[model samples]
Target: MAPASIPRRAALTARALAVGAVAVALAAGCVSSTESGGARLGQAQSWSSVAGGPPNSGRAHAAVSDSPGLVWSRSLGAPAIGVASSDGLGTFYQATVSERGCNLFALTADDGRKRWCLRLPTDGPRITATVDGRGSLFVPMYGGVGAVSAEGENRWFADTLGIPTTVTLLDNRHLLLISHLGIARVVNTQTGLDASSELPLAGEIPPADPGYGSPWCGSGERGCPAPGPAAVDTDSGTAYLTAWTPGAPAPELVAVRFSPGETGRLEVAWRTGLPEGRLGVPVVLSNDRGQVHVHSRDGSLHAYSTADGAPLWSTPVGYRPDTPPAVLPDGTLVSGGRTTTVWRGVDDDHSADAGPAPVVAVRPEDGRGREVWRRDDLRQLTNPAATEDGRVVVAVRSGGTDDEPGIAVHLLDGEDGGTVHEFDVPAARGPVSGLSVDDEGRIALTTAVGAVYLLG
Candidate 1:
């Protein structure tokens, strides 16, 4: 099928989509395993889920271009939310909100045309969906989990006890859904049924202290668990997430193991306490080692062993705490942050802030994080994706101090943090809210105002 151009609103259709012809190699940090000990057909080469697929290692193997040109752009009726997922071959899935419910759009990656849009009346706020090779999209929403086919049909819906914070693709047949109330459930992708019953992630919790360190205290709520997505290790059937009771001493990184079978179960593997701070992004796994890293809002990055959740190391990178680090193929981690400023408003009437933010690279060594390089230029970098050449690609809100006036796509050398290539987005309506790089070197970005752009 030839890709169509649909920059404006169009009628929704339940048309069948053709499977992509091109085949891509597996991404760097993504583990795509099948029951037959082979890679899955369409999903193996795709950025199938958030954070560059299951482990949420924030890594990929796309080609970086010296000058990326826009391939196409389409505007949704509402702004897209969360990280967009791509099937890598030729389709991308993004979600936008409406008054009644959520609208999930399946756009052709080649020309930014919508293949179909499925409306979900009970779909929750976040729209990060997980896609499989057989044209299945498993979405976690407010009331429950909904499965949609590639031809834009509602396959099934499984209700959950609480609102799911994130949906992670665990393996070939199962998905891991973590909810806000510390509930974890594994659902079968094919049947859309619970493989495991609702399991409380909080192993043993002390009674709640009404007004002590509890955000839900004022609202007369009993429990408030830290909300974020889980990172899965497909090989070991282990998934990691941050769990904290409102009045608990400290938050903990919890690892849960899911055994898939007729009697599938979700069991807590281990838990490790972290310093007092809100959890930042999703927990990320080290690409080469058995360590999992957590970024705390207090500007500290903590690493722990996956086997027992033992403390590995803690390092401070005093910048954008909300952004997670991207693990490269060589085991180096890259993250972006802002610089420290002393006496900000004292200099002028307006708050005089620091000029250039930093993009730092650190090597996780034995009991230490060795600083590799720091580039004090890039700012507002989305969760970065490592390319095939060990380089990093990021969407910068602003290219640099005097570089570009609008949103820019930057390809930086991972070795020295130098700009290898940069291109400004022609008509960016809003900030680059979501970025996903595919196996064929195509960079897909979504704006806050619902514009989706593809460049290569």
Candidate 2:
């Protein structure tokens, strides 16, 4: 493999400065939260990390507006790679690609003004970058991870890891990076150096093939190039990742354990097989720590025990789900997709027609899934986000007639799956790139045409 290209540091005057770690205070009544993996990450305010921290529960404690209007929209003039992440301190960060190269932009959350834009030096596409509680940003590139201070200054770039597939913030001080070859490494957030040794995934990596086309890591078949993001359980010191290994016809959900302090050897705890299909979505864990949910393309949502990787139950979703499920505070699972069924009776013969997808809510009980409610009016729904007060927010693509596509953002009641409030995305496109909720109940939605909209 080729080495990562290092950039010049003419403007990085703080490269040699020893930045101290910032300490965060926790409430006295939150003892159970301290045991969970998210508490150590220290990002309680913003969508500081992807899928809202290491657990990837896709739940936010912030409250969102029922009838949110578009606060602002800015076009990147290029396509964006992933969703924009926000720092609770009033700044939003996004990454975009163009003919020139990859650029990371920091915009003011209130007004959408460019605070600073930094050009990233990488050989390939970059995954969604994550931020720490101290306002530092960690981006996964082709070969390594780059650390940028909250002030938009380059701090340090760790270039030893090879072909990063995902970069996850394990805590306030450590980042867990999975490479394209199914290898995991830990990096210190403060120093941008290797915190521990690398551990290979479930199976041995296949030999490099020069004939393969571009290795797109975003969304595709199971293990298209490498594994997707991981869901970490800090209480057990284990991370659940879905990977494709040799001799397995399909992908397997592998459990790997690592020390959160980034000072111990990474170990493989257990591995289990998933159904054969496109495995693009990451795994989600129940807040009660009873089950880990895997939404596979095989038209089913599988659950397993977190202690020993034992199969608990599997629920058929009726359609291939394209996004991860969001776990509400009451342990209810909310998932949505693009296709649905509509029955048409012709001459007493019932035929099925394709209609807009419905957002389904399921409750796990007695080792089986019980359907709670379904909302069929929403169209082209993105991955859903849960608010602290038990509401679901999703972006719907409005089919338009002309060149410009219409977009609608919906807030649903968690109990009955009813539409509480709805708003339109002004001057946007069809495909919704990403959806995230910040600590202040602010919503951020990104589009394929490089459009970013902030709603509150």
Candidate 3:
């Protein structure tokens, strides 16, 4: 009888894992953040990180006008799998998720020209990238979190217990990441090593122990598993994340409070359950100052006090929330669903759709959103992008089947719901990571095929 044959690569991988404990400890020398992650160059655009700064407010500081021609469109020649980010140094960071090569490109925001491209250690279709205020680019890839200097040089790679989700830079020194196995860890941004726990994700879906796995870590899945990205409050040092445990009726929103000073400490600040997963990714909406909002997958919006997990207000946003609510300077709360809805100021009991309406506005105290305006024919599929000039920007698809594609960028006056200006995009509008706006009001929209449409 022939003996069972084991894959050579599998055997080597298992053996390697066994000996890695020593290597990780020896190589875990720490480095300090060479510079402050919050330092912004004068030329830096207001949009700092992917989620637009630690409070995780998705609004651009300033929204560009509606009528504008495409500045430039550059193709990485590969699918743009993850989110895009920028720093104070005028560099836009984008990554290509390709197996032949996964290269991180640094492009000039002025003309979208490639400054430099670095080949990452492994395929990066799932790699998430972020840049600090000082221009350090960080990404989760090749089984660890990696940092690239402002000059585009590979700095260091730290081993994580599991393939991490989108990393959150709490500060120049501490980084927040969670593995698919449901373990939340704080790694020294300088060292990538978690001395306290190793919740690995390479081989086992849930690992050998169930406690190490995330709530929804699939057993039959082929690749890595982890909860989505995190919503972090930099000033308060609190991070909000969500997860689903198997057999559980609802998902869990966990707040991790970081004690950052001389000692790096992480503790669960609070935990709550939502009706469904509708809250969306990086589920918490925080200003990092006073109030935090959490949306349930069940079309419910709940606001909580940041100091202690106390309920401030609860509003039922009739339609299921597809994106986080963006707050304008004037205090208007903007969100999207089947139609564009606005809470004149987070003050009303704005409920769902009543009739066939395009835009609705009401006060949270009203308990029902009143349809302020309607464009019966237009179907908006994106969150209402708030602008400084008092306009809600939306990307409208032609509803043209995939074969006949059209994306119309629309700008509506936030005060009167009037069309400010509209531009047609030649790119296909399948779905994107939401519109990216800079301090200059330049808007960027990337289509399904990795083509970026920039408008100023």
Candidate 4:
């Protein structure tokens, strides 16, 4: 599929102010996480109930439960930086900018009620926040980590050097934080502090004249480095970070592991030089699958072993592969790229079967994913959320040929990408970024403007 060239409009009114406030809050040191224990404030619930694709794809997932109804929409004093939804906990969190600094909000998921809000002192635009299994929200600040309770109270804080990139709960008590400079830290969730040990980078640093630094170094500066996303293994308590050389011809993908013990330590586990070119985030498949699937921007898929970082196989999917491979329950890998080719097959230690296998059923020995069927009607930018029984839901933005800009929801048969239901959302103002299905089989879509709509 060709890149959808939707004209970029000015930032939404609410988002603009929200972003401005976020910058101020970050500079003032106002952001922090919660430390006090309360009623299991919010329980982590599965967003989807559908099953039987590879390992990573959720069987039962959450879609927009409410329809074209406006739960609540507020203009951030600045631009909106990030948005996240907690497990069935009637609330979703958003990071936005305000005049004072960066602000975080806990809004009622059902009616968009403003449950609680916290302000930070940063002015930077790049912000990432995540909620743990215990309903504790972790916000990575410019030089530290902030913890907040679900009820909107500051718990504890920790300081660091490099800007934090990703934060995840290693367990109920430990939080893993990754920085752009290749630094990984494990913090005690209860204390809001890091252990003495820290991981170090192994390879030689590039000459830092201009563009010779890490990708994340130049986010706001001219011609800065572009950092890749980090993935963590929840069960092993290990964190993985990937990066490329400044001027390398073929991109080099490096994987390092940080093991937390009495003395925390980071070690270079395995590194592989790719065919040359930048790579995207490497998605880790959990449940002891021992495989890391990485999709490159140029449309290539590579699989690596989680244990030793050994390259298992590499294959081309299409011109611009955006969505990560969807791991079905039976071990059959369902993945699609730009060319309308949704590849499906069993994921073994062997190389990916060369030449597109005619969309067919594949059985996995592990009883994980069984390719029951394949269809060509399903096209999407993100991974298609599956239903508990066997339905796949996708979002598509229709290019306006003359006067109409529309978005459509297509339900596909899980076995084959056959169309099951098609509904067009008229008067859609922008591109759709998220598509979710509720427990009652209602489809909810989130647009770039932060408007979420329900499709029949």
Best by TM-score: 2
Candidate number with the higher lDDT (2 or 3): 2
Q: What would the C-alpha RMSD of candidate 2 be, to one decimal place? A: 8.6
On the 0 to 100 scale, the lDDT of residue 413 in model 2 is 95
Global lDDT scores for all candidate models: 0.64, 0.66, 0.54, 0.46
Measured with C-alpha atoms, the lDDT of residue 360 in candidate 4 is: 26
Write model 4 residue lDDT over 131-237, tens digit each, in one string: 64445666765455666656665555565444455566666666766555445567877666676356534233432321133232322111122243355565565
Give the candidates in order of lDDT, highest first.
2, 1, 3, 4
Over the stretch 1-456, how does candidate 2's per-residue lDDT look in tens digits? 111123333113212221211111111111122123233245546676657666777887688886888888888786664667877767788876544543678888889999888766432232466876556677765345667766666566665334555577666566777765567877776666677787878355544541121233334343343545778776666778777764568777788887654365688888877764444567788898767888776677888888878889877766655567888888888885541111111222311112355688888988888789887666644668888899999887565544555778889999998889888777766555578887778898987557889998
RMSD of each: 9.4, 8.6, 8.8, 9.3
Per-residue lDDT tens digits for candidate 3, residues 81-126, read: 4445667556667765443443577777789988888666422223
TM-score of each: 0.80, 0.82, 0.74, 0.67
State how far residue 24 of model 2 sits from its true place (Å): 26
Provide the lDDT at 423 for model 2: 83
Ranking by TM-score: 2, 1, 3, 4
> Which candidate's lDDT is highest?
2
Off by over 4 Å in 4: 1-83, 97-103, 121-128, 202-226, 245-250, 286-288, 332-379, 387-390, 399-404, 425-427, 433-444, 453-456
